[model samples]
Target: MKPIITTERLIIRELQPDDAAGIFRLDSNPAVHEYLGKSPITTIEEAQNAISFIRKQYETNGIGRWAMVLKDTNEFIGWTGLKLINTEEVNGHRNFYDLGYRLVQEHWRKGYGFEAAKACLDYAFSVMKLEKVYANAEKGNTGSNTILQKLQPVHTESFWDEGVETIWFEFQNNKIGS
Candidate 1:
């Protein structure tokens, strides 16, 4: 498939049904699910279901996570892209697009996460013409939170997410000048 975004060492492309195994390999590991408070998928079928759900997001929301493939090895590393989130804030706030990424443990700390994320943010701002994007990390996920820290600060707030405390971070599109 043609790539949606390409980084120095990675290819970001649409997720496909054949990606089920690679996704299962990434999401099924307990280490990967640590920060997100999610359970690892036990089988490929479950991963397929998750992929189907993400594919629907592209059709309905005009955006969704894409597969991240390593350029050197042609390996399916994980996923990264924008997602639409609904907020229950009492002030009439509703939906917004946010950035997110996940990669297998073996690829962690190799700079794949940030490379793909920075590319995604660039695309969202310049090509997609989005004004703002938001991201959040569980309060204790220092690794993920550190990534969010690299961007300019908007505000940090604590909230209960599915009963767990989390920190939300927002970023404005810089477009060309930013």
Candidate 2:
């Protein structure tokens, strides 16, 4: 497997076909899907398709979300990384790159999201040469919003998909470590 970034406790890597089962497990958990605005995945095929799309994003965008795995246990936890949000209103913004992540319920409150996200922000600003990275979380998703606040302050509240209220955060490149 082509690993993208390896942290002390996690290995951020490209999604693979074999990862469908793990992705299914992660996406099927209602608790995990609670804040994501979508229902739990009902089939492994859906996860497989998602993996394929993620692979395509890596090829087409050069920077896409990565599958995060625990290093010591080698278990698939979830994903974290950057993505391009090309919607017109969002596209009009100066910083179109967005940092995102999703972790399994078992991994919640374990600092893995923060650890992996910090690394992703470093890569976005330092390696990818992005000026800023943005992120959003549902209004009541305090855990995700808290993690984002550590990286960047909330710039505004926006509606995602014209419905859910999301708090958007922005991290400028100058703040990233070289």
Candidate 3:
């Protein structure tokens, strides 16, 4: 499949049915879920369902989390991209774009997350012409927090997310160049 965006080390593309196994491997890992509600999916069917849901977002919202693949090996490492959060309010905000990514356990600490995120942000500001984007990380997830910090979001706030304290960041397109 053609990629929506390509970085030096990764390809960002829409999620597909063929990615069910990769999603299963990624979401089924407890380590990968450590910061994401602590609930790992138990079946490939669940993975397929997830793919179906994200795919629908492309049609309805014109954007959604995308599959992140390796450039060297064409491997499905995980997913990364922007998502529209219009259905629910988060940190007193809705109808905004959120940047997110999840990678397999083996791919952790390898900078894939940062690479994919940078590409997505470029797409957000340059192609999407978005004014701002938001991201959040569980307080204990240092790796994710580091990446968000590096992005230099204009605003940061702490909020309770499902009983867990999370740090929310807001990145403005203008602030990036200022």
Candidate 4:
């Protein structure tokens, strides 16, 4: 599949049926799901359904989280991109472009997440021409929060919901990394 965005180590492409196993490997890890307040998925069918939902967003909105594959090995490690978000459906977020990323455990701490995120945000601002992007992380998830903080995202909101507290961050195209 042709990639929408490419970096030195990764290629970001639209989700596909073939990415089911990758998605399963990513979301099925309990450690990965801990900060998100969800449990690991036990079946590949669930991963397929999740991919279908993401693919639909591309059809309806023309943008969605994309598959992040390693260029050297062609491994579908995970996904990272801008997702069109609505406040009603996704609590703590207003209608805005949301920056998100998730990866399988073996790929963690190697800077792939940060590398993919920078490329995705660049695409969102330059190619997609978005004005701003929003993001959130659990207060204790230092890794993700650090990624957002390093982008110099302005603090948006800190809200409590469903017994968990999360902090929202925003990155304006003109002010990113300023």
Residue pairs in collision within model 2:
none
Instruction: Please give, for residues 1-178, the per-residue lDDT of candidate 4 as tens digits.
Output: 9989889999989999999999999999999998987788999999999999999999988888899999998999999998887635445456888899998989988988888887877877888888888888888888888777878875567777677788788787756662
- C-alpha RMSD values across all candidates: 2.5, 2.4, 1.4, 1.7
Backbone collision tally, model 2: 0
Model 3, position 63, has a per-residue lDDT of 96
Per-candidate clashes come to 0, 0, 0, 0
Backbone-clash count (model 3): 0
Q: lDDT per model, in order? A: 0.84, 0.82, 0.92, 0.86
Tens-place lDDT digits, model 3, residues 63-150: 9999999999989999999999999999899899999999998998999888888888889999999989999999999999998888
Best-matching candidate per TM-score = 3
Model 2: runs farther than 4 Å from truth?
Answer: 87-95, 154-161, 176-178
Better of 2 and 4 by lDDT: 4
**Candidate 1 local lDDT, 33-130, one digit each (tens):** 99867688899999999999999988988889999999888899999999987635412235988789999999888878878877888898899988
Model 4 RMSD in Å is 1.7
Residues forming the 10-long window of minimal summed lDDT in candidate 4: 85-94
